[model samples]
Target chain A: MKATGAYEPIFAGERRKRLDDVFTCYPTKRAALLPALWIVQQTHGWISDEAMTEVGQVLGVTAAYVKGVVTFYTMYHQHPVGRHFIQVCTTTPCNLCGAEGVVEAILEHTGCGDLGATSADGRFTVIEVECLGACGFPTAVMVDDDFIEGVTVDGVPELLGRYP
Target chain B: MGYPHEPHPKETLILSKHFGDAGARSYDGWVKCGGYQALKRALAMDPADVIEIVKESGLRGRGGAGFPTGLKWSFMPKERRKPHYLCCNADESEPGTFKDREIMRWTPHALIEGCAIAQHAIQAEVCYIYIRGEFTEPIAIMQAALDEAYREGVLGGNAMGTNRRIDMYIHRGAGAYICGEETALMNSIEGRRGNPRIRPPFPAQQGVFGMPTTINNVETLVSVLPVLNEGAEWYKDLSLGNPKSTGTKLFSVCGHVRKPGNYEVTMGFPLGELVNDLCGGMRDGRTLKACIPGGSSVPILNREETEACLLDYEGCVEQGTMLGSGGVIVFDDSADMVYQIMRLARFYAHESCAQCTQCREGTAWTVRILERILRGEGEMKDLDLLLDLSEQMTGKTICVLSDSCAAPIVSGIKKFRDEFEAYITGAKQPVAALT
Candidate 1:
């Protein structure tokens, strides 16, 4: 749940440059929060208020303005996620395809059920969410931005193996 | 396909047989089906008459808001300065809704032709299709279709050899549900945070780079092509009942069903028939416990309400909810209401757009309380607290995101109190009790 050394590089020169690139497009600085948060999330793996504050300062916006954009969308991570963040789609379509079984397998494997909860070994964190928008490929889970579809209970280990 | 034998309901501007061909996509394919002829015909008529035709069609917004499309178009001041814009809100992120995606993938030309007609109607020179970033493939497909239209003189300068020159572009959102909202979508298209703007001058008055603009959903505009071709009366009779809400709705049925996909059914079909017949009912002989008539935003309907309810705008309103986005999510007997609520609470908590203090703090509170109840650490007071917080969150924001998140929880707890109470009392009950 805490920021680690692996994520420290995100606050460095290149990430800030990417954040700067996103900021220049908006007429006002505050409008850059969502895209800045996305870049920070991509580099740091999650967004902290500190990261949000940094983004606010860089974009010449208030921390409150940055926080508002960060929390609005489900995709942004506010806290430290596991090395691999597994988002299992439990929306109507994926649920019909036995998304519950995928959730069960994930919980059994990770020993954590809460969103943003890292496993004891810091391997993975499982979050159940609404539709990921790939309804045709039902029972889909996004493992660190890559979608694995038609997931079954038996496929948990293999799905996790690709990450760690 | 033996899907169902339900009679086709009345038609409207959007659901006419003009582009109903399942395999319709190419510019030639659409032209063969009499597509951009509406745009050409519309270009020849006075722009006001084009708006009049839409007004005569009684076409309501197919997006969740259901605002009158003609009225929305009319809001754009004709005397406004140059560079009026038309934005197609293709950012379909509602939990159970997938109708737009199918249209984009299978009938891209329908959407393009509709956009052309809409641009001609509004006298807008530029159109932007703000698609969700998650729709990677669909966006590419749409872009390709735009290219094809340009190549064939269907789009871009001198569209179909007319004096009106309208160009279209596709801009993708990184990932934000609120961007599905019109104002937020304009912001996203303008390369800004997708947080919604306060409305006084609605998008019609001031939108997209501070010019007069009109935003319509993909399905809503696509329906226009058929309306202009077949006339308002022909389109109006497509629905089974309800003149206000006429047309075949693409109901995306999901959860606990044997046959779950986009089933286009006319308005006023019984919810029971849609599920039992079109959706082939619940799988494994399980009984239906509850249903979310629309997307995650609508109130959950208990089995009796679900069975008796009709699938239409007025029908759902009569049952104390709106037919929002036509996302029918069915839950079976084994489903856990407490856990389900917790999931919904978490989603709202994650997606609060945290601008206002009430939404930010209240959504987190709702999530915490729901999590406590689901974890069996809840007290009776927690339920009251949850309701109180949800009440405070509603109607206290710049956008309806707050209300959309709160409406279902307040209704869910009120209608399914026994389920919450059972979690508190630790009692064993029948599968039907929670629903």
Candidate 2:
């Protein structure tokens, strides 16, 4: 493999120690892959090909294998996203409670234009997610770590305002 | 207790007695509420005797499959050559289900105690509570509770001052609904893609790390505490004369209801009363039209069927649906059945691991056909195509996900054919946008 540009490694010094700490929780080193990827995602908003390679090297798994696990789950971002990532629930239960309209409202307010795309300002990226498991409070939206429930079309603007 | 509301008089609260109580989440608070006494008592008894008590209680798996909880534990070999494992499935990603989230959030110690009890019963040293990534608050709360438990000697090398070793850890799932499946969950823990494996050697035989494992739902494991304390006969008697289904279940009611939250009721509770009285009925003057009594996977029930239904495994089966996870989704007269069913198909399509051809192509095509109908671009032939496609999707995949996707499609077409016809006939306006 040839190096394209300067690629900073994630697991080093204190970061490597953190990965080792995660390793103690699991019986196998391969079981630390999920937590390892989470550490990468927390440090860097998205996972790049280089980061996958680094994770594979540290966990003794292949890069292709790491990518396979990453792509299988929807939470990991392959590319960079906006500062505030918003995921609105639009499953059957949420849809019955006008969740689609909330999605439209979120797009219109965030200026993200569509689902899975970030706004030109790079401040917001809104996407539709399947059930955030807070269906009792319908139209649950997750802005980063904040799980806001019972959101309505009118609440989109106020919700986005607080995020900014 | 109905989480966001006060406890109803009709409710039989055992596992959910401390749902909204913040104090119950702490280690000391849990002991104050009589928590670890069950674990202490169980650790002294023979593991076989513990399994027998649970079996006598008639507790079934709360996570969709109504398998006997004790029978699942008893499957573990008496002489454990390899390590035994216990996995508590906290991945509550089913569309209408949010009860497990509450269980971890408010009553974290209850789940911890339950897992400890289950670990001893199954002869497992380590228990992994697999929680989904989206539950950030519950994860934080549960992690803090675990730390406190370790500090207080509730869980450690010598758990509860006993000679046995008991260790518990939280394994966070990234974002996959299919990981809620038992086999798929084991695969996920092994750092593999979340796909359901073909089972010949089930989890109990060859499971996570190739060890004997017994996986129980968050609710099922937590119920063990009450059963141990109050006795299995008392727990069994909580049922409304339903010998097959015992104990109270937490029904996470959502959509088109007055009070949308988690409600705990005894087995064989009246579904209509749960909706009308407990949930405050269909949100003021809005008439109920349809309901998915179980989670999103089960067949949808029409108004009359929903009213006639009972909140139990056998009762739900009698009404042409299964009590899956007890995630009751209500729909009112204003809801468009065609559009809602399309949304459900899209969820299954998104969540499919795509390991099987039927699920991969079938879920995608199901969504496409449903979208066409919702867009009013479908013909009468499309419905037949959907029915035919659904037949192929069911019972063909390694997992029931494909069949789950087909349940509502087949049931919706059968019970609410007029809704589909209205969209095709241009009697109803197109609601879904074409991508």
Candidate 3:
């Protein structure tokens, strides 16, 4: 969570303006906490302790309060991850299909070797997530921002290649 | 019409009429398909009359509870006292429901029009469509459509020359299944943890920001367009004999079906036909083992009950399940009941917000016991213990999440006692350890 060199501010210049625009949408600055955290995550790969403090300073909330909200939601990454974060749906609907096989294939091919671990090559991180709300397309996987449908075990390599 | 499959002859596609059509995504494309006429009509009519029309159509909420939509809108103060808010619950994360995702991606304007009409009816000027963050494409599509609506005079300070203000924005949910709960959704919108608040002073009385608010599902709001376009009775005629459950519901069918997609069928449609015909039956000659007629929150149905059950509110209740979100998850002979039920419990356990001790403790324990049974390490008394815990979990929380976790367990043990007993008696070998 600590910065390597210097802790540059996240809400500066254009990002600050974007946060300000979102502030107008809400009656209070604290109400923009989720959107502000999203901006931080979208800019940096993940949220850090310093970044949480900066966001709290902007919204007039505390770093501890920001951490509580960030941890409550799963998408807000609290630490660093691989370049491409992969979430495979293993809920029952997908599980009934070959979703486990898909997850296993992803883990083997990505060299992550385990769920929630970034691959040694630092290209991908794989995790078995809950339903992505796309059940008809079983084995729905989200690589970074793109939500791919009907992913099968055999298609793991190609799905990984597209991200890199 | 089903998107992935060819439209079945019996499907009455009112909401999903333009589902797979790429042209309907554009604002002008939506207008060519006779969109926005409903908003114009709804705007001209008295707001109370609009409520009356929807009530006459018998359109209940499609977001699982199946509460009457018109009755819900009526709860908002007769006059606009303060800033009334409209929350379009696009946070669709139920295990088997994806209808709202398609509705937003395919026909964004349909949702926009529905929101505008609803805002006018409930006298709310600002609406926030709280979509889940996982839906990256749908969120972009909706934002683009909102831009179009604003530029084209369909929304803004003077919407379509009506001189009434209606503004809509998208509040992206980071990742929480519990946000699908109405009260939890408001908390999420306010940038707080997604926790379900206890009800008595309902959303209608004191809602988001301490003002009156109303929330509607994506399907429920889109259904508003048709009832206002065609007369209420014309829409009501789509249902089978049950006057209580009218209009076509989009059932998101998945798991072991040949043609898995959203199938729009009139209420009271037979579940057997939906699985056997509309979805092209069980996958490749596998015999039907069981079906979760609604989403995972409701009870599961065995093969015989699945064959005879009707796809409506009253009918699902008669079969000992609620028509929840119209998500039909099919199971074939090869599927394992004990393992799959364990997986469902795990989902609830992971999603529980831990605000209430009963849910936080009960869900985690349910998963442990179910995992034990799956591992062939369970004793006979564990079955009785699970049922006893399910009783305690059912109604003892701020939300029904604990109750939802207990639903499949209680039902699975009742319908497939042999399955659980097989694991306990060491008659069936334990499958590889559950992940």
For model 1, the stretches where C-alpha displacement exceeds 4 angstroms are A1-86, A91-97, A103-129, A134-137, A142-150, A154-164, B1-23, B428-435
Top of the candidates by TM-score? 3
Tens digits of per-residue lDDT for model 3, B1-435: 887777999898888889889999999999999999999999999999999999999999999999999999999999886899999999999999999999999999999999998998899999999999999999999999999999999999999999989999899999999999999999999889999988977999998887899999999999999999988999899899899999999999999999999999999999999999988998878989999988999999999999999999999999988899998999999998998999999999999999998899999999999899878889999999999999999999999999999999999999999999999999988878552
Q: Cα miss at B402, model 3 (Å)? A: 0.8
* Candidate closer to the true structure by DockQ (higher is better), 2 or 3: 3
B289, model 3: CA deviation in Å? 0.8
Tens digit of lDDT per residue, candidate 2, span B115-164?
99999988999999999999999999999999999999888997898867
Ranking by TM-score: 3, 2, 1
DockQ, all models: 0.24, 0.86, 0.89
Q: How many residue pairs clash in each candidate?
A: 11, 0, 0
Per-prediction fnat values? 0.25, 0.86, 0.83
lDDT of each: 0.76, 0.92, 0.93
Model 3 fnat value = 0.83
After the best TM-score superposition of candidate 3, give how far the Cα of residue A8 lies from its true spot, in angstroms: 1.2
Q: Sort the candidates on DockQ, descending order.
A: 3, 2, 1
Which residue pairs clash within candidate 3? none
lDDT of 1 by residue, B1-435 (tens): 111222233212243343335546777777787667777788788888988988887777877877878888888887647678899999987877777877887679888888988887788888989887667667877988998999988887788888558788776676677788899898877646677899877877788888788999998998787678888776677777788886567777777877766677667778888888777789899999988888888888889889889878888888888788887778888777766766666666676667788887887888777766665667888888888888888888888887877877888888888889887766734233123
Q: Which ten residues in a row have the lowest lDDT in candidate 2 chain B?
A: B426-435
> In angstroms, how far off is A15's CA in candidate 1?
17
